[model samples]
Target: MPIQVGDKIPDVTVMTMTAEGPKPVKTSELFAGKKVALFSVPGAFTPTCSAKHLPGFVEKASDIRGKGVDEIVCIAVNDAFVMGAWGKSANAEGKVTMIGDGNGDLTKALGLEMDGSGFGLGMRGQRFSMIVDDGKVTHLNVEAPGAFEVSSAEYMLNQL
Candidate 1:
């Protein structure tokens, strides 16, 4: 079954770009003792993801944090280099943490993997967002195919 409210985030390693370089971070360690607002896009730099998905979070980051969220994270089924570049392009530095699920390890673990072969993208994570408090899920918003309503930052902000 897919990850749901009340479930602990899966223990998996994902990559995040650091000043030093790309670093591997364990999901358990990232969420431990922290209230995190994490959103995942199908891929980085895509039209919807770049124009709306990521920008919404970047713009609303402080608002979300003000509500007691410790961190805001954005994960995509791309490599560290691509993720880092994309984050920079979106001006997400210090606002949203950009994570790379290069191998889809975390996405598969969450049971949110989707087949994007029809688009020549092979496999990717679905567009979704969740609130995790100290490693446990408090809310999850997953979008239906070709939809972009619930998972937006505006919607998540309302949830908070």
Candidate 2:
């Protein structure tokens, strides 16, 4: 089943780019005692993701954090290199934590993986957002295929 409010995030290893290189970060470590606003994109540098989805979060990072969110995270199925590049391009440094679900492990664990083979993209994560407080999901907004609405930063801010 898809992850929902009240569920604790799975303990899976995800990658984040650092000064040295890509490093493994456990999901449990991320949510252990923080109120996190996590959003996922199908892929990094894709049209909508680059133009709107990611920018929205980057623009609203402070506002979201102001509303008691300890961190804002953006996850994608791409590798740490791609994610880091995209973050730099979007000026997301210090505003958002970009994570790489390189093998779709986190996406699969949440049952949010989408088959993108038709578009030659292979397996990717569906666009979604969630508010996790101290290891428990408090809110989840999942977009329908080819749609972008509820998962936007504006909507999530309203929820907060």
Alpha-carbon RMSD, each predicted model: 0.6, 0.5
Backbone clashes under 3 angstroms, per model? 0, 0
lDDT (C-alpha) at residue 141 in model 1: 96
Q: What local distance difference test score does each model get?
A: 0.96, 0.96
Q: Write candidate 2's Cα lDDT for 1-160 as tens digits.
A: 9998999999999999999999999999988999999999999999999999999999999999999999999999999999999999999999999999999999999999999999999999999999999989999999999999989999999999
The Cα error of candidate 1 at residue 90, in Å, is 0.6
Query: Candidate 2 at 120: error in angstroms?
Result: 0.8
lDDT of 1 by residue, 1-160 (tens): 9998999999999999988989999999999999999999999999999999999999999999999999999998999989999999999999999999999999999999999999999999999999999999999999999899999999999999
> Each prediction's TM-score against the native?
0.99, 0.99
Q: Which ten residues in a row have the lowest lDDT in candidate 1?
A: 16-25
**TM-score of candidate 2 to 2 decimals:** 0.99
Stretches > 4 Å off in candidate 1: none
